[model samples]
Structure formats: C-alpha cells, structure tokens
Target: MLAQILPWYAHAAQRTAAAPAQALTAPARMGWSTHVGFGPGAEILGRDLRGKRLLELGCGPGHNAAHLAKHHQAQVTGVDLVGLQVRRARSHYGHIDGANFAVGHALHHLQATEQTFDAIYSVFGAVGLVAPELLLAAIARRLNPGGVLAFSVPHPARAGRHPSTDDHARESHVTVSDLIRLPLARWEFDAHRWGAHLSRTGLRITSTVDLRHPRLDPWPTTLLITARTR
Candidate 1:
C-alpha cells in the first residue's frame, strides 16, 4: 500500500511547494475546491465558517488546514492516514494556533473523539479512501448537530476511461476492497446513489455541485456534496 500511495504524497508535496508562499496567509474559507487550480476562493462550505471547530477528514499536506487556522480563524484538526502527509502538515503548520495534525484513519478519529466538531470535510481525501457507509457512519457521530459534512469525489463519469472512449456516459463501481489502479481507490456514485447512501447513514442530503471546468472536456468532473447529520 505504501508503494502504491507514495506517488500521491510526492505529488501533493510538489503541489504544496509550488504554491505561492503567501497563499497560507490568504483569507479563510469553507467548503472545498477539489479540482486542481480551482483555488480556495471557491469554497463550497459557504461563508459562515470562521471560528468554528472544523475537522478535515483527509487533509493532504495540511495546506487547507493551515489556511483555515491562519486565515479563517477556524480551530482545525486534520487527520490523514498517511504518516508522511501528517509530518508534512505538522512541519509546516504545527505552530499555528488552532491547527494540528494526526496520523490515523478517519473512522478511528471519529470513533475515539469525545469532542464533536462544528464542521467536518474532506478534499479528495478520506471520502475517496474509505467505504461510504463506514465513512458516513463515523461522520454522523463526530459532527455536531446541524454541522456540515462536505466532501469531494472524482466525477464517476470519468473513472476508468481512456479519455478517447466514445462513451461519455459510462460509469464504474469498485468495492472498498477492490484493487483499483487509481492513485486512491475511490468508489464513485451518482447523485441519486449518493443520496441513498447518505440517507441510510443518518445524514440528510443538502446539496451537490458539479465542478465542471468550462475549458476542460473529455475528463471526469469533480463532485462536491454537502450534507448534515440527522
């Protein structure tokens, strides 16, 4: 697993190093900009996240968490399954007042935490790593009442395609145990399927956004879904 996932960490580190040094000092925002280069300015969590206790489910390299803690004033705790990623985050932002990083499975953190968060979100992170049913079960218990659970997953419509495939509507599904060749083994589902899964997990579906770039085509779009615990 380490061999398969390390490439992703390397890529994240490169992206982090390539980002402007001043971005960490940029304004705080909620939600996620899952696509590459979309910017945090396009937050999906809406405009009311400041000072809230926020949890990032799969905080890669802690850039977003650092931004929230430094710029948004959010009391942020980030958890990543990858130890290196956690190290990267702590090395960069551990000194920030309201920001911390933990290396563990998201479900473990949720299961063990006595403290409930005001908001919980993942950015192309845990939501794509774990099974949906299991992920949502923990999320429901960890989030405060009426708190937000927002996450982004790859657009299912584009998974496993050659990009030159004539079929634009083709879709695929993978079980949690499946060996997927993608950087992260993500299980993709349509909006209706996601709604059904979230409903069963005791989360009320609030909204979903299709993150399609106007200039990009023949590639999968990113899907951002926002829900709340029932």
Candidate 2:
C-alpha cells in the first residue's frame, strides 16, 4: 500500500497504458519492485483448479497462471490487452508446460476462442476498463455450462473515504495519484453487481471471502467470489 501514499499506485494505469509496458523488460516486469498479489491465498483456490482448463482474463504477467500450471495441475492461458505484458509474461516464464500467455482484448478476443474452458478467473486487477456486460457475456459463452468461475473484485468502500455533511452537500475527492498506483480501471465491481452478472449467466455463487493483503492487514477492499456454472 506504500505505493498509494507515495503517488505511484494512482499513476500505474497511466504508466502502463502510455508506455504499453514497453518501458519494462521481462526481468523488469518480474523484478523485486513488482507489487501484485498472487500468493498462498490464491494458491489455495488454485488447488481446486486442478485438471481444469483455466482462462485468466487480464493476467498481468502470468504469475497466477504459472502458479496454476506448476502447483495446481491446471492447463492455463493468460490473456491481456498489452502486447508487452503478454510478451514479458511469455519470455520470463517460458513455455510453462501447461501454460501460455497471449495478447487479447478480453471481450472480443475471448469470444473468438470458441473452446469452452473449465474455469475462468481474474485477480484483483483483471477487469480493467472493459465494460461489465461485455465481460460477462464473453464469460457466458466461453465457460462450459457447468464450469466454475471466480474473481477477486474491489469493494465500493474503497472508491474513496466518505465524509459526513450534517446540513450540506459534500464533495468526494479522488486523486489521480490514488487511481494510477492502484490500477483501478479493472477494479470496478461489487458484491451486488457480481451477483447480477452470474445470475444472468446461469452461474451460482458458492462462497465468498475478504482477502488479506499480502504485505498489509486485510482490506475489505479485496472481495473474492467463488461461483459455478449452472
């Protein structure tokens, strides 16, 4: 979270989109400076992903897909809009046996895959700026009728701290600094909206949890959804 206060978190989105990750080499992308969360907690869920054909939407550098193939027995593929990120993921990770990463626009690209995956997942930053309806529709088409799906979405409480006004309108202040460092474009869903998409797609919610930050205390800001295709 130091990224937020330091003014980098809010600008990360801009930096990535502008430079298109062209500035960061494969090693640089996987460097010690990287701060995304894809560890033990993610591993636990991944264990359930074994033997499944898993699709990772907006998988930044394929860390989760690497974890899935190496530790969970899943055949994993990562897709992202950024060519450099996809390139870096592949170069740094190699042909991880059962894994691969590709350049993709989650909405249109996924629909063209035509193969139904056993499961689909997105980490905290997977959603990006893709329209919600487009994402769900693609998921509906790509997931086997009874396949599983899961996502880690940010909670609305994180939109910004709210201030009470006893008798007047209050302004909500959002900082570019806050938005950029956090990579928020893909982080725009809540429990209610999650339910809406799943229900329409014939997916059922099976469980939920408040994810603990890897380096800090638990953030209600991080919410996980476990669902199954119906």
Candidate 3:
C-alpha cells in the first residue's frame, strides 16, 4: 500500500505545487461533486463542526484541514502516508492556529497515539487504500465511542475496467461488472459488502450517500459513508 501511494502522491505534490499562490491560499472545496457542485456547499458531513477534535486521513496538501480549522473552529490534524504531501501541507498551512499536519500511515498513527477524536474523515482516503479489517481495527482504538467516522470511497461502478498493464495507471476506470474478475488492489465495495465489513469493525453505518460527478453520469461516483463507533 505504501509503495503504491508514495509515488502517486509524489506526482500529486508536483502538480499541486504548481498552482498559483492565490488559488493555494483559498480553502479547499470538498473534492466530491455528489449532488451539488464542488466545495462544502452541500455539507455532507452534517453541520456540527464547531470545537471538535478532528482528524483527516490522506489529507493531501492539507487545504481542507486548514479550511476546517479556520472556518469551523475545529482542531484539525491532517495525516498522509506520503512525506512530501505532509511537507507541502505544513509549508502551506502550518501557520494556522488549529491546523496541524503529520506524515504517517493512518493505521500506525491511530495505534500509537494516545489522542482520540470527536470525528475522523477522509475524502478519498483509507476506505479505498487500506483493507477494511486493517483500517477499522486501528480506527476502533482511536475513535471515541459514538464518534463519527465519515469517508468517501469510489463507487463500485469504478471497478468496471480490468487492471492496466502499465504500473503508472492510478485508476483504471471501468464498470462494476468488470471489477469481479480484475485483480485490483484498491477496495471498492457495494453497499451490502460495505455494511458487512463495517459490522465486524464495531462501527455502525448510519447512512451512505451516493456522490457522482454532476456533469458525468454512471461512470464514476463515490459512496459517502457516515458511521459511528459502537
């Protein structure tokens, strides 16, 4: 998993660094299109962010953490497995009073830290990258009881294509039917599979929202899941 994401995010760092300072300074828009356009305009995670202890997994460049700290009064810690992404986030948003960035794998951090959070979230993070059992075990330890865990994962429809021969392809887009035979590493789950996976993790699913690109239909979408620690 580390081997896969490190190079991918290294590429992301180069791409993200080239943006204008003004654009970088602006708070991050929620990366999903889902129902509405980009940004947190739809408030998919609900509206109770004030004074919460929040952690964002796979927070590339830390823009959303900075935004939450600045606007929502949340004490935010953003972690990414890749060091370059974490460094970029620190360089960009380290000055913010409530935003902190760390470079570490989420599962390892969750295991080692004494801290617990009111909520934990990932836009397109652990739910896809790590296996459910591994991720949930670590999360069960760090998330406070009844704490919210909100995350988004590529909809099962994305698994349509067969895995590409090229090692460089980050995402090989295809339909859900094609995914059954392909030997892909990323975990893309249907609602039933997701429900079963979470049940064993001591996390109870409260809702699952389907988010797709507004302009693009059926091909690529995300399942935004909100769960609570049991």
Candidate 4:
C-alpha cells in the first residue's frame, strides 16, 4: 500500500501547488459525489450546526469545512494527509472564523487528539483509503457520546467493472484529461457490510443513501453512510 500511496501523495502535492484558488469562498451545496445533483448534501449532517464541533478526515482543499463553519456556525477542523493540500486550505479558507486545517493521517490524528468532536465526516476520503476496522475504531474513540459519523465511498457495484480478487482494497487510477494518472487504493463495501462493521464498532447505523447518476445508471455511483456512536 505504501508503494502505491507514496506516488499518489507526491502527485497530489504537485496538483495542489498548481491548482488555482476557488472563486467561491464556500460551496452553494455539498454533495456526496462528484456527480452534480446526485445524493443528499449537507443536510445529512443535520440542519442546524450552530455551536457544534466537527472534524473532517481527508479534507481536500477544505471547502466542506469552510461551508459548515461559515454558514452553519460550526467549529470545524479539516485534516488532510497531503501537506500542500492543508496549506492550500489554510490559505484560501483561513479567513473563516470557525474553520482550521491540519496535516496528518486520519487514524493517527484521531488516536492522538485529546479532543473529541460532536460529529465527524468524510466525502470520498480516508474512509476509503484506510482499513475500515482501524478507521472506524479510531473514529469511535474520538467521538462524543451519540456523536455522528458520516462518509461516502465509491459503490461496491462499480467494482464489477474492474474485477479484483481482494475485496477489502482495490488498486485504481484517476486520469486527468489523459495527462496525469494518479494511482490510489480504495476499499469498497456495500451498505449491508458497512452496517455490520459499524455495529461491531459500537456505532448504530442511522442512514444509507445510494447516489446514482442522473442519467439513470443501472448501479449506484456512490454510497453515503451515516452512523452514531452508541
């Protein structure tokens, strides 16, 4: 996994440096998938976030955190594995009063932090990169009682397009305009499996939403799950 992840981190650093600052300070809507107009948005985290403490894992560029902080009045901390991404987040969203960014591995950050949060979330982020057992346990430890955990991952059904012997993690690559291919690994699990895993971690599954393409794709493109610590 290190062999695959190291290169992707380096590529991400280069891309982060070259990427231009977003014109919008905060997103108009927060969707689970990259597909526009698919799945529920920030409403999954609850309607009112005033005075809430939240943590985002693998918070690339920190738009979600900024949105929660700016519009919802939440105290949001966004952590990314890539240093450059965290730096970019601070540069762009630092003006926001309630949002902050840091660089660290998700599991390590959760385990090391003495603070606990009222909610934790990720959008196609560390939940897919790290082993579910380890990641879920770390998250549970850092969550306050009845705290929420929400995340999105590529649907397991999508894996049928690229068959893999290993069910836990699959090697994949992202192509950017046929110029750059960023190699990465993702762990895909259906809603049933996710429910079982979350239960074992002492979290109760509250919601699961399958995000399909607007064109009516046969299989869902993304899966969003929300759970709460017991």
State the C-alpha lDDT per candidate. Answer: 0.70, 0.59, 0.70, 0.82
What is candidate 4's lDDT per residue for 80-165, written digit by digit as tens? Answer: 88787787788878889999999998998999899999999999788878888999999999999989999998777763564233
Q: For model 3, how does the per-residue alpha-carbon lDDT over 105-156 read when each residue is reduced to its tens digit?
A: 8888788889999888887765567767888767767888778888877676
Off by over 4 Å in 1: 1-31, 34-43, 159-184
lDDT of 2 by residue, 1-230 (tens): 23222232233344445543322222211111123433224442434766779888877666777777766667888887666667656765655677788876777677788778988887753442455566777787788867777776554445353222121222222234433322223334456566766788677777766555456643445567777877
lDDT of 1 by residue, 20-131 (tens): 3231432344445545566334255547667889899888678778877887778899998767678777777777889989988888888988989888888877875676
How high is each candidate's TM-score? 0.76, 0.69, 0.79, 0.89
Clashes in each model (backbone N, CA, C under 3 Å)? Answer: 1, 13, 4, 0
- For model 3, the superposed segments whose C-alpha errors exceed 4 Å read 20-36, 39-42, 159-184, 218-220
Task: Tell me, by lDDT, which candidate is best.
Answer: 4
Q: If both were scored by TM-score, which would come out higher, candidate 3 or candidate 4?
A: 4
Every model's Cα RMSD, please? 6.2, 7.8, 6.2, 2.5
